[model samples]
Target: MPDPLGPLSTGILAEAERRWDLLTAADPSLRRAVDLQRGLIGRSVQLFETIRTTGVRAWPFNLDVGRLRSKLERGVPLLRDESWTLPVGPLTDALLDFCRMLEVSGAGASAAHISQAIDSKRLDAGSLLNASLARADCDIRDGAIQLGLAPDLLWLTAELAVSPYAYFLQRSLAASLPPDVLSTWDRGDCPFCGSWPALAERLVDRRVLRCSLCAAAWPAHSGCIYCHEHGDAFSSAAIDRARPERLLETCGACGGYLKALVSDRPLDFPLAAVEDLATGDLDAAAAARGFRRPALRKLLSAQTPRPS
Candidate 1:
């Protein structure tokens, strides 16, 4: 039995192709997302390869948040116009239209420039950045219902499968920053990015805080991941006795749960997303015991605007 997500890595690429086919067969609405996904995938590979060449020690992929901010500001107007075009393909057209809708919906200011740049500059840098932006935009449109912070949404979606290391790096940095730094920062298991945990693991023999962002593995005290609240009250239990090694970290006060994977398990496991899915029994057991995951809604309620 191979790991689903591991095999699904190939599936993601296959799915990418499958999506393209579906879009070609479907109507305008369905075509928009699939087109965006295809464009996003193409651009993602370029960005990931570029950043990976920089090595992990390169401060946050040497990505200047200041630069990202400036680009976004300039890109917003481009994102607004329904007629904007991008080189990523027809998806750029679809994305520009989507951004137009977001502006109309009050989700954020119109990013007409961001939309317009889809195929604007013929230069390599412009294409790469556009692809990065498109990747983030598509994910936001798809996952907006689950998590909603326009900027963070874009950042997380770009990192999801493309650059897991950069993803973790951005998240870790965001989490470590004082709230006074970024006004939009959210304090949650997702660190600062607001992306959901794909899975969690407990190195039984070693103490490591391996965050999904940046893939920066570190030493974290043994306790509940929800609030780092330690002690007997934060006990864990699981329904799969055969896999007693697998359990859920249950917090009584917050009613938040996280998957705890013992080090004995294979390292190849897609611990982030798959852990949660495989432990459906734990979720059921957690609920039976009056516990549940700390959804994005709950995390947002505690959001504090960064002080100047």
Candidate 2:
């Protein structure tokens, strides 16, 4: 089967590569990070294509438009719907491939250890993928400890692997919903996956939060997304006076900061990571100022339903 998202994915990869080249040319010091991201993006495309060709079914989310609208109004993430199911087989294959890609990319040796564990029957790819998808932090950490690998490293590998599936599901869910129904979602987290925005794109008149995991885009309010504080404590400043487009939005009330970049349009799936990486200096600057991004808010538990 032909990939449904082929053109969009191809465009994202091409644009990301072009941006990566420009970023590296501007600062040779970023070469290492850019190269690692290049490897991950290439592997992600391959995994996404593989899964797409295998033809996974759409998530069985509630089709009642009224109910979906009510849920959106209540600030409920769609992932909380009990009817949704995960396609474990394709996602598991993606996870295993992602582990190997991590090793090949020189991102870490922990993924190698993970692959070894799987080979030795010490780990199950489906279980690992499920844990990662559910954002079961403690489970992942405990498993990492048992495997003698860094918890963060293992979690990162698993999350990256499962992200393509998340993207696919989110896209399908969004497509199924009426445009007005989707527009009702105004929360800080992703309506589909419940993940927080990696950053926001500053369009001509409004800001659009970009999901870190599923790459979903939604309109955002003008204040601290975490606290909804629009008081004087919320302020924005350009990281470099020369490049006013790149900014750091800080909220003193929550002690949280979000990176914002002026863009002509919303970024596609996976490219949000590239933008996040391209603005590493903003992260450093925020850290220097004692501001930090908040941890992923747990909007839902591990509710992975069995595939029908």
Please tell me which predicted candidate would have the highest TM-score against the true structure: 2
On the 0 to 100 scale, the lDDT of residue 256 in model 2 is: 91
Question: What's the lDDT of the predicted structure labeled candidate 1?
Answer: 0.42
Q: Estimate TM-scores for all models.
A: 0.42, 0.89
- Cα lDDT tens digits for candidate 2, 1-308: 34445435466678898999999999999998888888777777777777666656644666788987887787777655444445666666666777776787775577788777876767776777766666666778887787787788777877888788778767777777778876877677888777788899999988899988878888887799888889999998998999999999999999999999999977877789999999999999999999998876755444642211
Model 1 C-alpha lDDT per residue in residues 23-106, reported as the tens digit of each score: 456445445544444454454444434433443333423235564344334322111111212223322333444455444444
For all candidates in order, the CA lDDT equals: 0.42, 0.77
- Lowest summed lDDT across 10 adjacent residues in model 1 is found at 77-86
